[model samples]
Target: MTKTVRIALQGLTCDGCVSSLTTAFMTNPAVESVTVTREPSQATVTYNSAETTPEALCSLVDDAGFEGTVSES
Candidate 1:
């Protein structure tokens, strides 16, 4: 099954941050797509639930030197 999550992010300053995070998320084969916004400081990620979890996705963002929390809505 595929699941999509919206992650609230902090410490993003530029397009480079977006590109870097997008690349990081894509490194996981389970990730289907990633869309990041600078103004809102959030990322929408679609991935295979069987292969990954929302927590794991947040970890990816954190590992990229940013703070990420799974948005409830």
Candidate 2:
């Protein structure tokens, strides 16, 4: 199934952060799309649930040198 995850982010300082994160998420085969917004410090990601999980997605953000937590909203 396809799932959409909204993640609250920390440590994003500029447009470059958005670019880097967007690139990172786009590299994942499981990720269908990614929309990162800096003003609100969040990312809306769509991915295949069978191929990845919300935890793994947060880990990916961490690996990219940022912090992320699954957002309820």
Total backbone clashes of candidate 1, pairs 3 or more residues apart or in separate chains: 0
In order, what lDDT does every prediction score? 0.95, 0.97
Candidate 1 TM-score over all chains jointly? 0.97
* TM-score for each of the candidates: 0.97, 0.98
- Cα-based lDDT at residue 16, candidate 1: 98
Best by TM-score: 2
- Candidate 2, residues 35-59: lDDT per residue as tens digits? 9999899999999999999999999
Clashes of each: 0, 0
Colliding residue pairs in candidate 1: none
Question: How far off is residue 45 in model 2, in Å?
Answer: 0.2
